[model samples]
Target: MSRRGQRLTHLELLERLVSFDTESSKPNLALMDVVCDYLEGWDVPFVRVPNAAGDKAAVFATIGPMVDGGIVLSGHTDVVPVAGQAWTTDPFALRIADGRAYGRGAVDMKGFCALALAAVPDALAADLRRPIHILLSYDEETTCLGVADTIARFGADLPRPGAVIVGEPTGMEVADAHKSIVTYHTTVHGHEAHSAKPMLGANAVMAAADLVSELNRIADAMIARGDASGRFDPPATTVHVGTIAGGTARNILPKVCTFHWEFRGLPDLDMGEIPALFAAKVAAVTRERLNRYGEFGRIETVEEVAVPGLAPEPGSEAERLALRLAGRNHTISVPYATEAGRFQEAGIPTVVCGPGSIDQAHQPDEYITLAALDSGAGFMRRLIGECGAP
Candidate 1:
């Protein structure tokens, strides 16, 4: 395809992709259908790694030699929900104006997906020495486990790639490090009693408040410790509470309270450290607050989501290749969590480099500029040259 043709095809694919309402809570099989069909039209072989429930899937396709030492281009198909956002146009409909393409996933990921798909013909025409694999997964906005099943297949039923480039909205910067995210839900169980009753029952709401306060103290400590490498923007591993619910009436001691909390850890921070501190606080809260009157209350916590961080691999293949292709000399760290960590955990060197700014992602009118898209296309072309016949 000519340059114009490629640009047109990229926009067309982005339009088609953004049409599907593949929110994190919804199934993305429909969007996968369009992707699979496009690959099929080019006679490209791919596999679908479906979730355990079979409602969603991750598609993996290889272009050129399917042997080892290939590069993997990874992107997620799911976008955040648009139900509560105020949009100037339909969130699912692609709109182009002012040199920007607007839609829910256009920048957050679908832009990179479009660029990779558009390069399929170019990759095939290169008759490359090594392969270029494209992986599209689900649930990145929520669990980030959509690629787990597919990653598990590497070196078993699938060919392992030499490096991975996760196409997150990094504005074409090569990101070698990112934070890890772990979410949790805590529930305080207490006995209900009349407000006038003293030493008769434990108050769940009060106990939950104490726990939240403890978390605040822990968050302060993390802030003081700061990021050792001084690469992160916030400069610290941070903790937050998203929601809290409890208490039926003002006159009665609440029987149950629940809250959702999470921590985004710096790459060097121990993953177990936050949980251990929170557990100790929970124990103390249960003993001193929840069950002060008797053994009338208890606290329980469940780990909900755990997404690992991407540590800096200064001289790794992914960093070197991505920086070279992106026309850059230095690497930066993103505060967001991405599936690149999953690839890193699988012993694959991985980096995050893609089009569009993270600022445009998850907003009411998410967009990717034409200039950024063009730059991404150039990057793809250079990648083809690297793996092409030499």
Candidate 2:
């Protein structure tokens, strides 16, 4: 039994959740174990979808009558790694001080997951005319690898809800728009020789520098393209290289160079333009550099993953329902990407609303204010009152 009046159940649940280190690189089965046990105790039937390796899984469950026109509450169980981050408190253990709870996933976003799990008892007690669904996914901290396969099972192995509420950190406001994300891994291959002989070998590092320069020029042009709505900061698509590795020694010319990069575009923006242009540049490098001695000099760019942005839909049923539940009359826009876009693309009206702030996400000593969780609790409580909700 959940003690809604006690106010500690949600906090306690968050503590328990953060205790398990479900970092994207590690197996999330332990966290899934806790979730399955909780749903079992509630006697709620759920569907489990595991990755091909069975190292991770996603859990989906429904509460109330088995019917259409239901609502789905979605959140991910994985958090980013705290490997090199400096923190005053333990990232795996929950700590409380100054009306804030500190932990790795406290704000983005085990806080919302705890609140959703803690509200099951209240939802069970209410005389709901429509059902409520819970979607707990894994590997969201990475490239949303876990949820992609799991969402494919929707409406086949699982009930297709009318609307989905993605519990990403939104400070308890309804968010209907965000930016799309596209990631790529680029590798340049060339012939190696001693640095003393410049003409004998093709330098991959130099080629990579040229590619990076071209990417910067494209970024500037995108900024010139501009956002007409003025909702996004900088009001343009942004490109950046996150990681790069190459070279064996300073004296030897680099034969291989690899880098991981991504671009963020506004909603409804065509994401293929940047990659297409980059491909053209890569071909030019390959054609011009390849010769009798440099037969292997080439470049390759592969799409790691692509996540669509959540588009703003005015007067959407999801918007109206979320506004009423959150006690707000309007919606807002964010610059982050969430699984809400996937649901929306699948024809399910979707919105993002949850606890905490995005600024605290992936930062040292991350915490969610007790007040923020209180606001989340109020939203969940109102969600349970669906019988009379607009």
lDDT of 1 by residue, 84-178 (tens): 89999999999999999999999999999999999998998999899999999999999899999999999988899999999998888999999
- Give Cα distance to truth, residue 292, candidate 1, Å: 2.4
Indicate which candidate wins on TM-score.
1
Top candidate when judged by lDDT against the true structure: 1
lDDT over C-alpha atoms for residue 227 of model 2: 89
lDDT of 1 at 16: 90
Q: TM-score of predicted model 1?
A: 0.97
lDDT on C-alpha atoms for all candidate structures: 0.93, 0.85
Per-residue CA lDDT of candidate 2, range 1-390, in tens? 232233347988899899999988888888888777788787778878898999989888888877777888899989998989999978999999999999999999899989988888788778567888888888787676666775686777677788889989888889998998999999998778899985688788888887888899899998988987788886888999998888899988889999999999999788788988898888777766533355658888899879888898888888998999998987888888888888888888999999999999999999999999999989888888874233
After best superposition, candidate 2 residue 111: deviation in angstroms? Answer: 0.7
Error of 2 at 152 (Å): 1.4
List CA RMSD, all candidates: 2.3, 2.7
Instruction: Report the lDDT of model 1 for residue 277.
Output: 91
